[model samples]
Target: MAITFSDLHTEKGIKSLDQFLSGKTYISGDQLTKDDVNVYAAVVEKPGDSFPNAAKWYHAVTSRLAPSFPGNAQGVRFGGKAEAAPAKAAATADDDDDLDLFGDETEEDKKAAEEREAAKKSTKKKESGKSSVLLDVKPWDDETDMKKLEEAVRSVEMPGLLWGACKLVPVGYGIKKLQIMMTIVDDLVSVDTLIEERLTVEPCNEYIQSCDIVAFNKI
Candidate 1:
């Protein structure tokens, strides 16, 4: 059956994705594709700890697509409830040779197949070792330019860091805090280091007074 999710930013939609991903590695097939990319894009933040399956899938897709993620796609809008689109069929090899059931396969072909399987396994292992984090960045005062603060925060880029969606939330007395989501490879990014060294230091600190981790969950 085709899986469907509502507005991915909502709890209901995230739960739907979590349920659909249960016991499944990829959304449409055994490998990652544009289908995974589209769904991942729709999810504004990491799934909460309550939804483990969706969290795992989120990090897996993020880790795979981080290097060259499609940041410039002008997304299509569906009028009503959006359904998960099916993955496109992969192009098949056009080998004209007929299969010889009685004949042994070449040693080179066996080695190639083994290599592919090994790569897939490696990717899965890597995917499981990542984490997602949500941070609340408070500014020095109400006068602090939130746009400049966000730009400064985003400027601190690292190899394993992938920033997600963010929005300003009202704190009190006309003050707003920046709540942001990000995914990280466990070994590559230390949340403590990011806050102490990059975020609450130097130029970033000019706008950002303090930072607190709202949630952290392993994928």
Candidate 2:
């Protein structure tokens, strides 16, 4: 019941926002209001294309809200590097727990935490120079075997390659999606080539219709 109500509330909110901002420059009026700030903060990480008016308002407000720094320019640096996409949806909610979101912290506390993590990661990168990449795999037809696809991806070889996680997500219409993450040394060129060649060689290619590198960055 709680989940149902939450879903209904979200649906209604999207509809209300779309209707309310039809002729307005901001959520409240031409001038900025607390309401606009609140909504923009809540959905800034979400893909803008899904909500036209909200996207426009979010970009317009956030562009002004973002602070400028001297050296970095970008105010904050949490993770080592940004992922290709923010991932509109995850295979599991906990999948992103390790990524810092600056939640429920005082300004000083958040800054200190980010600094500590960044320092630690910088040291590790100096030692290992490793990175991570996420791949999205899909089948061409109903006849394709999922087990083979998984086995094929698992079979790829790379020096210093470390398998992270693999999960299947149902994307509706009786179709599903496969996502896998792997860590590797600073050899993206070789790793990418190996994945492309291996996935299409024999048994793996028989099942996998398409595969793509969704996210790749140093961890």
User: Candidate 2 lDDT, tens digit per residue, 4-23?
Assistant: 11121255565556566777
Worst 10 residues of 1 by lDDT: 86-95
Candidates in order, TM-scores: namely 0.44, 0.39
lDDT tens readout by residue for model 1, 25-74:
77975566445756865776667799999988877765554433243112
Predicted structure with the largest lDDT when compared to the true one: 1
Cα lDDT over the full model 1: 0.75
Flag regions of model 2 displaced more than 4 Å.
Answer: 1-128
Q: Which ten residues in a row have the lowest lDDT in candidate 2?
A: 1-10
Clashes of each: 0, 0
RMSD of 2: 23.7
- Candidate 1 stretches with Cα past 4 Å from truth are 1-128
